[model samples]
Target: MRWITSISYKNGDGEVALAFAPEIAQFLVQLKKHFTSYQLSKAAALRSTYSWRLFENLERFRETGIWEVDMDRFHTIMETPKSYRRNFNDARRFVIDPALAELAAKTNITAQVEPIRRGRKIDRLRFTFENASQMKLAL
Candidate 1:
């Protein structure tokens, strides 16, 4: 099913209108009522899929400022390649670093990821994030 079914322009005024599928319209209305516009705008502005996904996951922990995920889950969520999935250096260099950089540059979030070691190998990741909006409220 498509989200946007049609688009049109108004006569003379040159205004544009979008016609969304019913499910999409309902979902958008709900999002508008319940979600913050700032967060939505930030998500829209992000260029990397990794950055966008990371932003979404971190927003849930804005109040707590921390998120921990198993390496396997992180790999699944970020869709890292087989090579990168097992290699922490490659994953961090190719996936994590770029995503974090984009998020810092494009959004008001500052985040850092630290790998947790289990025995001799990395097993999990701990993410600490601070949102500018949250910081302003705290100040």
Candidate 2:
């Protein structure tokens, strides 16, 4: 499902409208119950697209503090390109690691990736993280 379908705004007027697909609308309804919402200000401050996407993904599992995603599905979710898909190391270095680093440095969360392997090849990634404020409170 696409995150956004179309956006329209007047040239000089202070009015705008966004049209989302039915699936996106349903997703938003479901998000209200299962997801932890982030402040728009904070989200807008993120400079990297990967960082923003990672934050949203992790926020959905904020309560659980852990998320497991297959590498293929993760790549799809991140909208990774075909070239990067062929090299796991490159994908990790350029995409996943940078995203995680940005999230840890700029946001209220921190995460680590644990690669799940099938024989000798990496297959999935298990992300474990916690809200920094929550961690402080627990300590």
Candidate 3:
């Protein structure tokens, strides 16, 4: 689904305008009713693109509280290039760790990564997180 249909901007005066398809509005309203949503402020505070992407992906699974993603699929979702695919440790160090750290510090959720290993090689990553707001309410 396309989030934006058209955009207009003024060169000298810095005026900007956006036009969305009528269908998008309906879709957004339905999405709010059917799926979990995140705070725009929190999303904006994320320092890296990876952090923002991971947060959105995790937020969708908030009801389940856990998400298991295969390394290949995760890399695809994160748009990692071929060079980074060969080194899981480097990828985790440069991408996943920083993103998860920023996410934990700046957002109302916390996540832990559990690597699933296959005979000395890591295959998948299991992510577990809890909604802090819900946890507080439970207490």
The TM-scores, one per candidate, come to 0.68, 0.70, 0.69
C-alpha RMSD (angstroms) for model 1: 6.5
Candidate 2 displacement at residue 14 in angstroms: 18
Question: What lDDT tens digits, residue by residue, belong to model 2 across residues 20-112?
Answer: 898778877786776577777556757988889888988888889999999889988899888888888898899989999877767778899
Over 4 Å off in model 2, which ranges?
A: 1-31, 34-36, 134-139
Better of 1 and 2 by lDDT: 1
> lDDT for each of the candidates?
0.85, 0.84, 0.84
Global lDDT for candidate 3? 0.84
Over 1-139, each residue of candidate 1 has an lDDT whose tens digit, in order, gives 8888999998999899999999888788778656533447667778888898788889877779999999999989888899998689999998899999988877889999998999999999999989876322222
Q: Order the candidates by lDDT, highest first — what do you get?
A: 1, 2, 3
